[model samples]
Target: MRESLKVQPHHLERDAYLYIRQSSMRQVVENVESTKRQYALRGRATALGWRDEQIIVVDNDQGESGASAAWREGFQRLVSDVGMGRAGIVMGLEVSRLARNNADWQRLLEICALADTLILDEDGVYDPTSFNDRLLLGLKGTMSEAELHVIKARLRGGILNKVRRGEYRCTLPTGLIYDQSGNVRLDPDTQVSETIAHFFDTFSRVGSACQTVKAFRKDGLLFPSRLRNSQTTVFRPLTASTANAS
Candidate 1:
């Protein structure tokens, strides 16, 4: 009854914009239920008096992060439509789905307020033009941003714990490999081991990275570089950057 009062005929006359998003491709693939729940909001729009054709599902943002609106084309389109008074109601499964950033969320709320557009989540219908609804929406946006921060903090803490315990496995640099037993060991290839030893020997003698690179170039020595994605090593002319990194 209260939801019906907030959604006016004027709102129903315009299109209902249903914005859908997931933070990562992993979520889009593994979290099938969540995606289905978001798409099911089309039925919610129908219940709010929007026809099938009048409901626009903006799902281009799938597998994209909500930390910012800079790279989200779907979010930009929704904001543009709302600002142009084309969207009668903007719907999402939750505020976090719409935007996890306070700036992006508040901007959307402001535009919806000015356009007299409604915001619909699983909770209830909210009229952004109404002061009370606007405040509640603001709080939800803030909470969404806070929620993201908390998740990141927890993940960082777990990674740091793993690092302290020497359990964190990082990519091995060139001339090093993780053996079958997952122990760090030198490359089995004698050429790779010899090249790395010679480079260091030159570096120690030259006492300068730039001079070491020049020495390799002058000696016409090709450095053995291991490809990141494969165990194969390729010999290439060593640049200052590569020498410095080594």
Candidate 2:
């Protein structure tokens, strides 16, 4: 495979990096196939003559956005290694995994070109220094960036439409919930409703959130709160911030 792709002896001397990333935590959890495919690039590297020791998988950026590379430590490390002439080939599932920002993608391209590093994806192998390969990679980067914009715009438009129709549902903090028809309504629990109503009424009378919390604590009452991981209600001391938010 290395011979077919023109992988030279010098290119095999340094490390081969398998860079992996996902746009968000939800994708990291739901898109198992994509993540597995990216890791499988390790086998491709080995088949290209790089030994197991020479392969490095940078996966710290999982569950991170590729729209920018500023906060991606894994990408930073990959670029640093390439710039320092420690990487022979940088591989990813695709260009989007490297970066969805053109600036970051171009910067990586420049570094790889200068360091004589190869870039590999499922499509094929590419030498950044080569004009044809560089041009194709540049186009991929631009398309990736544009794709991100298109997705954002589409999602934003849908959300705005939903909001206009009063259907833009969000998680209710407490004392409220969506009915079967998706309309917002107060919680069905009588005790929960009374507690929340009393909290608001007390706060209104005291004219201070801090005072309301103090009154609740003085009365030895446990403030009701919704558990994060479950719908079950729990009782705890009222926090000033929670009081204010309510």
RMSD over all Cα atoms, model 1 = 5.8
TM-score of 1: 0.75
Question: How do all models score by TM-score?
Answer: 0.75, 0.74
Best prediction by TM-score: 1
The reply for model 1, stretches above 4 Å from the true place, is 172-176, 180-246
Q: Write candidate 2's Cα lDDT for 1-246 as tens digits.
A: 543465888999999999999988889999999998999999888888999998999999999999988899999999999999999999999989999999999999999999999999899899999999999999999999999999999999999999999889767888887789987888899888898889989988999999999999999877789897567888889999998898
Positional deviation of residue 242's Cα in model 2 after best superposition, in angstroms: 8.9
**In order, what is each prediction's RMSD in angstroms?**
5.8, 4.5
Q: Worst 10-residue stretch by lDDT in candidate 2? A: 1-10
lDDT of 1 at 83: 92
